[model samples]
Target chain A: MTQFNPVSQSAGGQASFIAVDWGTTNLRAFLMNQDGHIQAQRDSDRGMLKLGSAEFESVLSDLLGDWLTPDLPIYMAGMVGSRGGWQEVPYQQCPIKLEDLSEHLFWLTTSLPNKVAIVPGLRGTGVAGLLDVMRGEETQLLGALDWLEEQGRADESPIFCLPGTHCKWAQITEGKVTQFSTSITGELFARLNDESSLVKGLPKSNQLNEDAFKKGVQASLQAGGILHHLFSARSRFVCGELAADEVRDYLSGVVIGHDVNDTLEALKVVSLEVPKSPVLIIGSEALSERYALALSSRDLTSEFLAANEASIRGLKRLANRQAVSANNPTTGAL
Target chain B: MTQFNPVSQSAGGQASFIAVDWGTTNLRAFLMNQDGHIQAQRDSDRGMLKLGSAEFESVLSDLLGDWLTPDLPIYMAGMVGSRGGWQEVPYQQCPIKLEDLSEHLFWLTTSLPNKVAIVPGLRGTGVAGLLDVMRGEETQLLGALDWLEEQGRADESPIFCLPGTHCKWAQITEGKVTQFSTSITGELFARLNDESSLVKGLPKSNQLNEDAFKKGVQASLQAGGILHHLFSARSRFVCGELAADEVRDYLSGVVIGHDVNDTLEALKVVSLEVPKSPVLIIGSEALSERYALALSSRDLTSEFLAANEASIRGLKRLANRQAVSANNPTTGAL
Candidate 1:
């Protein structure tokens, strides 16, 4: 919802740069003038899942054609660099900073004469004391950090959670992502509702049942034993207590319950000392609101960030930093 | 593979009966002799999923040929009576005896000359203090109970667990299924391994990883808060500590963990005074054996029964009881 003019002149005629956050299932393009203000923006279904590996460049070119020339520098992020994406960009293990990601970036060369760089995904130590992998969302967390800094409210350490197809919970300390964990909660919910017989009889809708959702989240967080109460949704339905449409809300609760539990557990194991830090949640409005509600039930406070805006801001910051380094020789170049 | 010899002696010289165990994706037929022996067995691809509705009888006729004569009576169990199956037979609520199911039995008249009877599935008060729904396997549990009674070993209550696509846990007390529960653990396991990207790169094999499966079962039993440990299999693979092929085992662990957790929770809620009752597990040899091993680790004893045998035995018992009831009016019969 933040509006910016692409053709606006900020101090000079030279535009700052364009930042494109390209992902597997969606494409987001942002044209920024000198001050990291988006001049124009566009989104399309040319995501990695749809285009796959071979057609990625052609699709990218097709989407960006006439908006800019092929030689225009574009910074990409998300699953675009995953193994199944356009290219296999190796993952950068956390604790990673913007500089670390920028230094180890993967570039895509096409017949089109353009400079395109893909930001690497983040892999971190998992809750089980193993490597946890994530793609695309790390840069958005960086953008969120930049936004906080610009607001002059940046903290030494912050916990940012980006909930989506793959929910990423990152710990940013001193501008570095010290650690993060990923949960495929969204995908799991979708699969259970859409494909599985668990909710085969339930109607499909975006309608949310606050009571059911809260109950599920609470049960998920408070249920002591290892038992999963996901099937309880159907059980509730069969009992004639829950309506068909409310099954979706119940499912959302189950998934969010598991997500909150996992994130809490991971933080406990890795962080050792539970810092009473305010959590920042970055996701779509609906999902972010749900996460906010779930967190609130646990007496946890958080700041919600829109996924698209966060990604754009994050890429803009990266482009600006790169441009600054390219213009001034005194600052150490990443 | 226990073979039974047909009983040659009957009121009539001819054998006129058919038994079927029709599940979600598979159909098995038994051409039975007067003595409850399989004269000729056949299987077909006309499972519930394939034969939408109108083709159920036609497919049976195609499979049976001359066996579809009017003089013969066809008895069927399993999903063929579910909502998606040939006919939606309302479930018989438990604390139900075999006699209760037979008393409320519904008959389906096909265009074919023969009489067809579809066995009703069971619904029960769930261990979670909810309504539990089940089909197909409940009839098999009844058969198992009949077989136990006939063997003169029916004093002790037995826990009959039919683990497959939908694992059914039935408590058979005094030659009757008093209660039951259903878990979608098997279906979930299959989907995660075969369809989901979580184990996208894993190799396919039917072999069981005993170590992984047992560890998974144990972990599921002990884990305190949530079922997120289910994803540890993927994490292990992503961490490079586990080979792609070994992912199957890790998945085995995840599913079994949840299974064990659910089973334990169910048992706790169902049995008020009895804490250490022996469980009878019936399923495919491999999965049943894995569950047995899992049970053994907790110093609990379990009896393994093949699903095929149990279903066959159940059908035989039902037919025998029906024959007896038809012959003698005063005798209380199932």
Candidate 2:
């Protein structure tokens, strides 16, 4: 693996390409110029899941509007590269450096004539040596790496906690993503908070009950493990220890707490160097803070990055590297 | 708590009462004669949950037909006694002998003039001192004692696993329920297999793939715990390790296996005696056998009792005791 180096884009003022972050339920796009600056941004709910009947090209063309230049290259990340999306891109295996992302880009033979490519996802050995896969987080992880090197923390091997519907915990050593694990904590909480008997009659909201949520986090470290602690949400509510409105947040705490603890424990079990440095928590402000709180509860420190920005930045770097390589064919590393 | 004594009915061969096991999803009623024999049996899908708008009495009346005799005392158990049921009967605390159930039966002031009653639920300390609950399983636990005593196994102190949508694990010592825990394993599996991304677009069914189910059981014992292990259902499928039809049963195995292991571990942690004798698995034949497989995988022996029989036997014993005490005002033991 190469030592982490910030990719410097070629000197050009005009717009270069577009970056699309397509996931299961939402689509986000960033218009990037020659030097990795966001020219403009747009978002829509026409995610990969909703593009079942709608053609991906038509959706992209419609959403991008006048920005849809035939010559401007577009680099798409996330489920847009998944099986059901615009095209199925194979996942690249782990232990690969961030810069390698540019070389493995799954270029499309689109109607626009070699003007589009999808960032292939990553697969790695996760907790218990079980196979774990991530579609979108890998890009954010690359952005995370790029961001870290820019911060002059490139030599630091730290754990990355990307909390979302399916949270990803990546262990980056040197410049390579050595190993990572995935937790369905968010998705589990979503399903239970919405449909499980645990919250059957309770008031439903995305609003977090802070104290209740922390109580759930505390419950995770208790004797019974995830399957049992989950019942605490319902039992505590039944016993009047938790209010009806607090049930969802309390459950969220329970699952998220367990997710963080288990992933950390698994990393420890594998003898990974859990850095003394604060864990890099990459996601939205609310969730990242929630994770930071959970980590702090265990006396572990953490920092955060907006997931969208991470993806956009990561895609921007990839575009820059690809552009630089194309401009100077003799250049090996950006 | 008093030692469990077999409740022999009064000397008479007349149709005396009915035993109704009404839960959230289904209702089963057994017509009992003067003794503990089931004279007739009937079942309906109009369970307590479905009785939201329909009157419980009207539903019973429509289903039982001639069996709904005004004077035919009906002893009901399960969710029929829960908050949303026919009547809200309070839960009896643990450490009470099975026979104490007779004293706590919340007799209803019904249209039939003191001819109807709902057996209460049970509450107790569970894993990690977290309060766990069970509504319908109490009646089964009572019946379990009756059946055990009938088999001259009254001295047994065993872990009782009543598997269902909400699985119950009760620690029975000296014929008394000392402690118990509830695992939402079945419910979790139902929701995940039917709805989650783990099994999304995969084949869905209640059929168990023995190989796949056992593989899941093995997976539970591996690292990363439940949350991470759960993703294997999807990860394995995406990587072609698990087949489409096997996903449901595999998930079933994972949850059931964890449920069994966690409950036992919780019992051990709480310093409760997980008896050397086989864990008593009470439920439908298929579910009971499934649990037995899970238990055996941990090198634990288990025995099964038809859940309906247990409930019927329990309600029958309660009826016999109530009838005997009513028949002979001076008799303390029938």
lDDT of each: 0.69, 0.79
lDDT of 1 by residue, B1-334 (tens): 2223332234543574788988878888888877665778889977898777888888888888878776677779988987778888877767778645655555786688866778787777656554667777877776676566666766767667777766666777655677666666676676667666677756787787677666566544432222345555566577676677777776677576566555665576556543455787878898888767766766778887678888877777666666554432221112
Candidate 1 per-residue lDDT over residues A1-334, each given as its tens digit:
2223232234654454567777766887876666566777777888877775888888877777765654346788887887778887877767877655656656666676656777788777655544567777878887787777777777646577788866777777777777766666776676677777678866776667798788667655533222335666665676576777677787688678768766776677677755576688888889988888787876778787788878887777666555544432221222
Isolated chain A: TM-score per model?
A: 0.88, 0.91
Angstrom error at residue A216, model 1: 5.5
Number of clashes recorded per candidate:
10, 0
- Candidate 2, position A254, lDDT: 85
Off by over 4 Å in 2: A1-13, A327-334, B1-13, B272-274, B326-334
Give residue B265's error in model 1 in angstroms: 4.4
Report the CA-based lDDT of candidate 1 relative to the real structure.
Answer: 0.69
Task: State the DockQ, from 0 to 1, for candidate 1.
Answer: 0.21
Evaluate residue A103 in candidate 2 and report its C-alpha lDDT on the 0 to 100 scale. Answer: 84
TM-score of candidate 2 chain B vs. the reference: 0.91
